[model samples]
Target: MNFSAPSGEVVADRLSDFGIWEAEYRQTLQQFVQEVIQQAETDLEQEPAPSRPTDVDLQALLDDLRAEIAATRFALQQYRQSLSD
Candidate 1:
């Protein structure tokens, strides 16, 4: 007699693949965050002493960072939904 495999095995395989992808995605995201932080710190440290007022460029940098963080949050939410499904 021949035997057949279980349906759940397919799902388990998919989940395993997803888990690996998720780990890599998380690592990449973390590296991006660290780089952003390092860039901000370096920019601040390179500034001249209190002789000048705050620059508009700093505000632009902050806006860009906020947009990136918002995008990351959206991606995380989608990933959570995929895990549940």
Candidate 2:
């Protein structure tokens, strides 16, 4: 007869539904934030990898420096011999 106002049972059911919806919403929001953080970290690591020199590059540089030092030593020896002769 008085259908305008919801019954007590109806109000309680709606409140329960609202609580469940709120909990699900909070969980989903937290999961989304976690995924965003992980993706940002991955991007940052990748950005630096190309800019940082690898072990192979450093080894190559060292080899070139040794070769240059050897060449300089040979040149100095030849110059000393010429001077003495």
Could you give candidate 1's per-residue lDDT for residues 20-84 as a string of tens digits? 99999999999999999999999999997687655569878899999999999999999999999
What lDDT is obtained when candidate 1 is compared to the true structure? 0.94
Candidate 1 regions with alpha-carbon error over 4 angstroms: 1-6, 52-85
Q: For residues 1-85, what per-residue lDDT tens digits would candidate 2 score against the true structure?
A: 6569888999999999999999999999999999999999999987855555445787788999999999999999999999999
Taking all chains together, each candidate's TM-score versus the true structure is 0.51, 0.52
With a 3 Å backbone cut-off (N, CA, C), the pairs that clash in candidate 2 are none
lDDT of 2 at 38: 100
Residue 7, candidate 2: how far off, in angstroms? 1.2
Best by lDDT: 1
| TM-score of candidate 1 against the unseen true structure | 0.51
**Stretches of model 2 off by over 4 angstroms after superposition:** 1-3, 49-85
